[model samples]
Structure formats: structure tokens, C-alpha cells
Target: MKIVRPFSFVLAIALFTPAIRAQDGVKKDDKANTAISYYKDVRPILQQHCQGCHQPAKAQGGYVMTDYPNLFKKTEKEVIGVVAGKPADSELVKQITAHDGKKPAMPRGKDPLTDRDVTIIKQWIEQGAKDDTPASAKLPTVDANHPPVYTQSPVINAIAYSRDGTLLAVAGYHEVLLHKADGTALVARLIGMSERIQSLAFSLDGQWLAVTGGNPGRFGEVQIWNVEKRTLKMSIPITFDTVYGASWSPDSKLIAFGCADNSLRAISAETGKQVLFQGGHGDWVLDTVFSVKGTHLVSVSRDRSMKLTEIATERLEDNITSITPGALKGGLQAVDRHPTKDELLIGGADGTPKLYQMFRTKDRKIGDDFNNIRNYGTMPGRIFAVKFNADGSRVVAGTSYDGKGEVRVYETTTGKLVSTAKGVNGPIYAVAHHPKESVVASAGFEGIVHLNDAVTGALVRDFVPVPVKGAKK
Candidate 1:
């Protein structure tokens, strides 16, 4: 020791100090790690990010993580779940951590996992991924008879009216609940599809109801059901796992829908054949509406632009943006055309509903208008659904960014705020106006469909299709 060099002394301290810290770090991580069990640490992460595609009911790629047993089972692709104590060897870890431009990542449409989240997952697996779930954490096996029960408000993704306007089809978990338009009785439940019903539309003739949705990241499908027969007519499988805006043609011969793959496609109602594919959206296309004349189709997208395409020619009619395009920000989420004019009512993340003249004369066009006629403000959330109230004089918009569900009715021509429905209690995803009356129906996160007088905004009827005896929804 008396002859030891300065370098030797420093090296000894470096090695010894790290060893002490390593021991301390392990102690700390383990203390935190003790709380990391399959039910506690891992399940919440999967439920938020992975369950949409991996749950038992959907089981995309035959990987079901709805329970502890399902979570640890090897995937259908023959991928190992967790090699004991070896996150580096586990296929689940590799897939989630993988970054390849040639292939899409896990949780296809949403954000990827964080580094800390990855560490927690690895630690859980390293600790044997024990099943420590409490009794209350267990969920019922989801099936036709045991469909997903809403403990909280269920988001209404789509809604439609029968051609005759006698029945309303409200989107439900693995089913479409058909209710009397007046909300007086339950007509029937059209059950099919895996989950996530995005859009529903009764065929123009009202003979068929076309539904668009799928287990995101696993499969995207369009299911057509015969209204009277209440049977599946066609199940058109799409290449992507998510689709939006199933729009029926004016003649109801073909159905056009937008896909996650940034393409607009059409399928023949009779043959189930893909007839047209137009790729132009720079991002996800959110909604599509057939022009009243059926000569063109208008689509809005996350790209912050609304486009018009001529159907027969499949050519671009115009690429329209908001009035304050450079300043205003948010994806356009909904679009509905005037019943008789070429004007469009659009809503988006910006929390305002705007009326735009799709085809304006030179005299009618404003200074650098970009088709925007006027925008209605004062709404507190992003507009998710908008429609011309059968007559085209009034425009209705449903909004969602905030927790409070809001529906606004405005004078289509004057952009005057006519009526507003408050106390929706959650986001309003789908809204429809009675074809022959002043009544309007709205449903969303609350699960209850609320019928209101379009003029007075008075709640006339509110009913839950699948009522939870003691639950809020």
C-alpha cells in the first residue's frame, strides 16, 4: 500500500464504488419491481396499447392477452412469449422494440411504448411474470352471449337510420342495436364482427346496413347485413386493420370507404369486389361522403385537407383546406354534403364546424377562400360527426376532445348558431336527424342514445340499449 501508484488507487476506487452502487441500484429496482406482476404492471400496459388487437375476442395473429394464461401463451406465428428471465430472447420484447421502416410497428395506429415501459415489461418477465391479479380485476370471457359489458360509458362509434327512418342502428360492442327511432323500444340486435365499429350506413335503398371497422392492426372488414332478413350479406375483408366512413352510393350499388393505408376504395355491394382505389391522402382519411348528386365524393383526413373526387373518372376535383390553413391546426374528422347544393359541412380537431362551398361561382368565391364559406366557433371540443338535417337548412355537429359531449345545430346558410345540446356527459361520436321530423339522435361515450328536438335542443328521450343495472352508462 505504501508503494501503490496513483493510477492503481484510482482504479481501485472506481471498481469498488460501482460495485457498491450496483448493489444499491438492484435493491431499489427490486423494491419497485416487487410491485410489478403480470396483473398489476403488465396488464394495464397491454390493455391500453396491445389489447385492441390481442384480446381473446379479436385475437389478431392468434395472440390473446386478455388474461394471464392467454398473455403467456405462444402466439400463432410460433413466437415465444417470454423465455424465462430472458427478455432478449422473447419474441414479444423483440417485436415491441423493433424499428424497421419496411414494416409497421406494434400498435399500428397509435404511439409506441416508452423506454421505461419496456424496462418494466422486461423486469416482470425476469421475475417470472407472476399472475397476481385480484378478483375484481378479472373480466368475463367475451362472446356473443357474454359480450363486453360496459363498466364505464361506451363510446358510440357509429349510428345510422333505416331508409324509412323508422329504426335507428346504434353501434355496440360486437353488435348493432336496432332501436325505434323514437327510442321507445328495442327492435333487434345485429351481432357480428370482432370489435370497433367505426361507421354504419343503411344502404340508400335501406335494404342493407353496411358496417366498417375491425380489430385495429389485425384485420379491417366491411360487413353488410340485410335489414329485413337480419343476416350477414357480405363480409369484405380489407388489407388494413382499420377503416372509416362506409359511404353508400346514391344508387346503393357500391360502397366507398377510406382506409388506414391512405387510400380510398370502393366495393361492389353485390359481388364484394373492390372496384376503385384512389391513393392521395398524405395521412389517415377520417370520413367520406357522397355528394348529393352522386357525381363526386368528398373526403376529409388527418392530413388537414378535404378532397373531392369524381367517381366515374376517379379524378381529383379539388383539394380544399381551411380558411386559416397555415394558422389553424387539426385533422378534419367529419364531412357531410348539403342535401341539394355542392356545399359541405366539415368538423375537425380544431373544435369548429365550417361550411364550405365546394363548387362556387366566381362571384361567390371570397378572397383566397379555399372553399371555406364560414366557420362556427364557441364549441369546446373537436367535432367528430356532422350532418345536414335531412332538409339541408340546419347542420348538426357532434364534438369530442373535451369530456363533455356537445351537439351544435347551426343555420347552414347563415352560419348562425341555432341550438346547442349540453349535458351529453361524454363525447358524441355519432348523430343523425330523423328524416321526416325535427328530432335528432346522438350517442357516444355515454352509450345512451339521446333524442332531442332539433329546434329547441330539448332532450325528448334517452335510453341505453344494453343497460347496466347499477352502472352510470
Candidate 2:
């Protein structure tokens, strides 16, 4: 006869065997029934592909997918976008599903969604289309009426004067504040969803303002605002980080900007469609400027090089800077095209304001920085901003170091120092010259907008762009 095991041992084996089987069964069920999250899965797909055209500011075809509730609402065609527990019957599923080998009808002009993304969206709807967006992820409604309240002055990354010299646009938290040229009164607050305003530019005709920025890690956006109507005309979401150096084309038909992803991009100012894309930079592209005629784009990058790209062909025409190692002392941070010429005013980590011809006139040589026109006297710190006057006769550069900032004006041709602005403290990240007047606007680590006389460099006036909770307006 077989030896009998102890009673305790037998009991333990029996208990452990069923427990292992039960655990395995639970894990398998969990793996099969995993819930698809609207916030985590579906939202990102929409944000990357659909939100640009379907947000509140731009409800394409009278349908919006920016919010979960909007997905279930009926579209302009009276078709429900999503129907809970029935993916096959949902209009959204129908629109996204290929038919007769034809591409999906939605996301017009863009590539069809990947099979995986479409499957995820369908699965989410099939699982009852529940709202699982966390409260912490919800952003407060911010607009002109419900503007962002500031406890302290936000870091000013950019400032611009309207083409007509009537209004000044200063970058603030989630908004661009329009002030009178004299800085005595606030005109209007143009607000958007981007938290960081990296650059601001007004169209040549002064009808629109182009803004570039975004949540640092989430997304980048190019915002076109109708200045006269004070309304957001277009919001084009781009790469997965903040964008910089927004500049409008001469005809105001296109807006170009630099990206943290080392690419340069341009989009139609009207429809927000990407019309141009150039990805030649080796590092983060920090600034960009369009050639005077708008035929080409010049982008400066943290790779310590300036590159020229042909807009028509999306071809990288040349590296404007020298290809020799260590030609640039450091990465470039700012660039501005001359008002009427194919010349550029640039500044960056080296603290020198440089003027460079946009196009190469001679054959390329590896060691030659042939396009470099002139180099102004080095400032005390890194130059974060450089701008040409309305006539391109004078250039202003702003810098910051050792917790102090300085603004210097130089004669563009002779490289003669015009004046150094007085009474500037903190790191200066932005500077703008009035289109018609002698006023120069500067702001940075300190949130106050300082208007100085461009000729004499005397402080004209300074004011906080935002309303401080306890301070006078």
C-alpha cells in the first residue's frame, strides 16, 4: 500500500492548488476586460489628430471632440458621434472605419488613423463610453472674460508691437496682453490654452497676431488671433513640446515657427493646415525668421548653427553658419529678419548681436562664415532677444547674467552703440521696437513691461501687464 501523507500536508496542497488556479483565472480575465480610458487613451489620440480642428474655437462640421460630452452629441448631419455600448452603430465608428477600400471620411486632409488607434477608440466606445477624465486633468475655463489671475508676474518670454505701433502685445500666463503703445492703459487680453507663450508676432497688415507656445511636455500650438475682432481664428497643435519664434509671412498667409523637436514648420494662417515642414536641425530649433520675400525660412538652433530652408521644396538650402566645429560660441536663441531686406539680426549664448546676410553669395567653404555681416560688441550676458527697428537702421538686443539684465541699441550698419537702457533689472528675455515711435519694450524675469526711449535709452514708463490681486490696476 502507498504511504499516506500527513493530514496537514495534504490539506495545504489542496488549498494551494485551487488558489493558484483562481489567481491565474483572475489575471486572465483582467487582461481581457481591461477598460479603455478616455483621458489616458482616447484623449491623446484626439489631441494629436482631431482637437486642432474640433475644439471649441473651431468646430469643424459643427462637431467637437475636445470634450467627452461633445462626442455623444449629434453632429450637424444629425448623426450621433458615439453611441455607448454599440461601436458598430456609432457615427464616429462609421466615419473612422474604411469603406470599400476608401479611407475614412473624418480628419480630412490628414493621414488615416492607425489600425491600433482606431481599434482603441472603438473599444472605448464599445465599453459604454464612460467619462473617466480625472478632476486634476481638467483645465479651468480661460478666455477674455475669465482671464488668468496672477499672484505674481509671470516670466515674459516675448513682446511685440502692433505693425501700426498702436498696441503692444506682451506674453503672460495663458494669454497675450494688449496694451496701449504708451503703456498707460490695457487694451485687451487675448487668451488661449497654451500656458507658456514662447513668441508673439503681428501680421504685416496688423490684422492678425500669431502666437507660439504650449504646455511644455503635452503639446505645442500655433495660435492666430484676429486683432480687430479680438477672437481666436485658428489653433493648430503641433509637436509634443513648446514651440518658439513665431513669424508671419509678408502677405500674412503663413506663420512659421521653431520646435523643440529640432524641426521648423509653417502653416496656413487661414485654415491652420501645415503647408511647410523642415527637419534639418540637429538640436532644438529655438528661433526662426522668414526671408523678406517669404520664399525661404531661416532657423537657429541649439546645435549652434543657423540653417536656411527653401519653402517651395522643403529643401534645406544651406547652413548659414560655418560648418567648422566651434564656430558658434553657443546655441542661438533669437533671430529677426530685417524689415525690408534678406538680412537677419541674431543673438544667443555668446552675448554678441550678429547681423548676417540671409543667402550665400559665394560658393560654400567648410570653414567660412561668409554670410556673417557684422558682429556688435558683446553684451554682459547671454542675448535672449534681438530685433531690428522699423527701418532696419537700428537693432536692439537684450541680455541677462548675474541676475541683471541690459538692453542695448546699435546702429545696424556701423555697429555703433546707440544707447544702453537705464534702470533694467532681472534677466531680459524679450525686447520689441515700436513700429513707428522711438519706444522700446523689454521684459523678462521681472514681469513688468519697461518702455524706454530707443534713442536716449531713458525709461519712459513701466507697468505690470497683469492685474495683481492687491495692487492698483
Considering only N, C-alpha and C atoms within 3 Å, which residue pairs clash in candidate 2? none
Off by over 4 Å in 1: 1-153, 322-328, 360-367, 469-473
- Separately for all candidates shown, the number of backbone clashes (residues 3 or more apart, or on different chains) is 1, 0
Flag regions of model 2 displaced more than 4 Å.
Answer: 1-32, 59-64, 67-105, 130-138
Q: Mind sharing the TM-score for model 2? A: 0.87
lDDT of 1 by residue, 1-473 (tens): 02223345347444443223446556754544444666545765675566545654356777866566766668888887767677887777877785555332676544677765676788777877677877885645664456556655466888877879899999887678888888888877776554778999888788999998876754577888899988777666674356898888888988988877677788889877777777777677778888777778888888788888888888876776643447447788888878778788888888889888876455423335657788876588788898888879998888886577798888877888888874466888898888889877888887878888888888898888765547663
Candidate 2 clash figure, as a count: 0
Residue 305, candidate 2: how far off, in angstroms? 0.5
C-alpha-based local distance difference test score of model 2: 0.86
Give the whole-model CA lDDT for all candidates, comma-separated.
0.75, 0.86
TM-score for each predicted model, relative to the true structure: 0.68, 0.87
TM-score, structure 1 vs. true: 0.68
lDDT for each residue of candidate 2 in 371-471, tens digit (9 for 90 to 100): 99999999999999999999999999999999999999999999999999887888999999998888788999989889999999999998888887777
CA shift of 431, model 2, Å: 0.8
